[model samples]
Target chain A: MKVTVKLFASLRKDRFAVDDFDYQEGATVGHILASLHISEEEAAIIFINGRHGGPDSPLKDGDLLAIFPPVGGG
Target chain B: MESLKEYLLARAENGLIRLSIQAWAVQNFGLTFPAAEETILGLNLLPARYQRNQRSLSCGQQLSLFRSKVAVIGCGGLGGHIVEELARLGVGNITIVDPDTFEEHNLNRQLFSKLDNLGQPKVAVAASRIKEINPAVTIVSVYDAFTSRNGSVLIEKVDVVADALDSIPRRLELAEVCEKSNIPLVHGSVGGWYGQVTTQFPGDYTLQKIYSRYIGERGIEKDLGNLSFVVAMIASIEVSEIVKILLGEGSTLKGKILSLNLLDMEFSEITF
Candidate 1:
């Protein structure tokens, strides 16, 4: 299965902003993060198709996965 | 008491009142600048300082802004710019809260920080700057950190609140307090070339939902540090959100988060 992945903020420092990658069937968000070398700790907010998602949440083909880093600064 | 409308009409230059005249009216009639400005706005006369805001903001809307109150939590990078914009936009009452003082490192992005006032409190500097920018805006500076214990008192009667805090835990706490008070919170945060803004009305749980799994005092900002441009941009967006909430004009970021990547200049809105 393939999923479109989007990264935001510092999460895109060395990574692509939006791209697609192949993952095994029934792959979870955690699997996608691991594949991108993005640690779960650095991924503050994750959304699947614009709604909140978690690491344990499963993804499907053609799904849009977005990840954002924490930006707690004044 | 004299009729301020007649007095303002007499001094009007092309139907626009100057700041000097407004100041004179405030002094002579013992009226607050906001009161005098409101009178000027009531007569369809513009305050020269606010001329740039015309068309975008009508006289009625400007008068409405002069009657609103806002509370800005944290007086650092985002807070300083927020306070400055609110005062210049003629927000009538502003309450600023921060416990930290200026330091040498804060010169990069903190708006109110100056080399000579390194030890001065951030809120104190903000109060002084607000008065200098727009005397019609009243400022209440609190030289203390915002916590759940004192949050209610700090934000009492405020129509809107802006979250410029640096701590994730504190942001969550602030959301809780605003929720209880039934106030709208315009939240903004910046780290390096990235920033995000969202509005959380009562029970929106936008902040709570955003930071649900985050388990840290700070975020990527600790590693990337903040830049001047990103801080100012986010602060301006937050101010716009506050203005919309006050005047009921324009679309706001409520129920959606505007994620800004300044490096790539990409702005994406993610709806929750």
Candidate 2:
């Protein structure tokens, strides 16, 4: 199963902006984050194929997973 | 008063009047500049002072902006720039709330802060700067922090609110107040080279969704610090959202957050 992963804001500092990952069948968003070395706390918002997704949400092949860190300031 | 109206009408050239007519109306009729401008617009006459704005905004839309009132919470990095833009855009009334004084640290990103104003209150400087930018804008500076107790009174008369605050708890509190007041809020935040903006209406739960896990935690901005360009960029976006709301034009980021990363030069929009 091939999934395209995208990271935004500070999440991309030490991580690649976009990458392709081959995961096992029925892999959850949490599993992807763990594999990318991104802590669940660091990924504020996650979207799967442009729809809001949670860590427990499962990702299918050819899905686009987007992760963003909380950019909170004034 | 009838004679003054007649004088203004006589000054009109092809149904378009110059700002001098507004000045005359203000002096003779004892009407404020904005009041005079609105009366002129109501009579289907256009003011020459708004000639530039007429290109992008219709005469009616410009009048709407002149009649709208906005409240900006916090007078630091974001608040300073937002107020500057709003005044230049001719928002009739602006209520600025902040209790902090400008220190040396604020010189980096605050628009109104200067070496001479190091000890001055942020709202006071904002008021002075607004006056210099557009005297037609009436600014009411509240040199107090925006807490739940004072939020209602401060924003009761504003058509919209801009959340320029740096604290998450205060942002959440302001969202609750806007919900009760039924006013739309334009929210923007910046950290280092990154920034995010969104618009929240009553019961949208947008801010809560963004700050869900970090409600009590401080933002990463504390560690990375804010960049001047990022603050200006986010503040400008917040002002644009307010303008759209005032004119009732275009789609707002009501339920979505637009995040920008200057380092990566990437912009992303997420809807929750």
Candidate 3:
């Protein structure tokens, strides 16, 4: 299965902004973050196909995953 | 009242009343400046302070803005700018909350922070600044944090709340308070060149949805260090949302988030 991954804000530093990669059928969001060397803490919100998804949420083939970092500041 | 209206009409300059003239009315009629302003706006005459807002906002809309009350949480980067704009934009009543004093580090972005007043309370400085900008505005300065205990009272009579807090947990607490009170919250946050804004109505739970996992008191901004322009931009957007809410004009970021990256110049509207 293949999934499209998009990173935003500071998460794009020294990393690809958007790309597609092959993952196992049962791959989860946490798996993709780990592969990208991003800790779960660094990924604040995750969206799969424009809907909120969790790190433990499974990704299906042709899924478009987007990850954003926490930007809470005054 | 008829005499005052006639005087205002006679003194009007091209259907606009100057603040100095309004001050004269306030002195003669023994009325507050805002009261005089309300009378002027009621007569469909524009306040000179809001001259630039004309055409963009009719006299009726300006009157509504001058009659609205808004609470701004935190007096840091976002809060300072938010108060400045709200005051200049003629928001009648403003409640500013912050427990901290101006620090050396805040001078970079906090609008009210200056080299001369580092140790002064943020809310006090904000109140004075609001008066300097627009005396018609009534300011409520709170010298304390917006905790769950005080949040309800702080926003009890407010029509709208702007979240300028820096802590995730505190933002969540504010959201809960506004939700319980059924007040709309215009939320903005910044980190370096990145910022995001969203308007959440009562029961929306958008804050909880966006901030549930990040309750550690801070976010990426702790490392990124918020820039001046990012804070100002997000603050302006938050104020715009507040104005829209007050005047019932234009669409706002009600059910979506506007995420901006100044470095990349990318703006994305994400719906949740």
Best by lDDT: 3
Once superposed on the true structure, which residue ranges of model 2 sit more than 4 Å away at CA?
A: A24-26, B13-21
Candidate order by decreasing DockQ: 1, 3, 2
Q: Which candidate, 1 or 2, has the higher DockQ?
A: 1
Error of 3 at B213 (Å): 1.5
Report the number of the highest-DockQ candidate: 1
For each candidate, give the TM-score of chain B.
0.96, 0.94, 0.97
Report the C-alpha lDDT of model 1 over B24-56, residue by residue, as the tens digit: 999888898878887898898889998899869
Fnat for each model: 0.82, 0.69, 0.70
Ordering by lDDT: 3, 1, 2
DockQ-derived CAPRI band for the predicted complex in model 2: medium
Better of 2 and 3 by DockQ: 3
- DockQ, all candidates in order: 0.81, 0.66, 0.78
A best-first ranking of the candidates according to their TM-score comes to: 3, 1, 2
- Candidate 1 chain B lowest-lDDT run of ten: B1-10
Better of 1 and 2 by lDDT: 1
Using lDDT as the yardstick, the better of models 1 and 3 is: 3
Cα lDDT tens digits, model 2, A13-46, are 7678899999999999999999888877677788
Q: What is the lDDT for B192 in model 3? A: 90
TM per candidate comes to 0.96, 0.92, 0.98
For model 3, residues B127-207, the per-residue Cα lDDT tens digits are 988887898999999999999998999998899999999999999999999999999999999999999999999978988
Kindly provide the TM-score obtained by chain B of candidate 1 when compared with the true chain B.
0.96
Cα lDDT, model 1, residue B56: 93
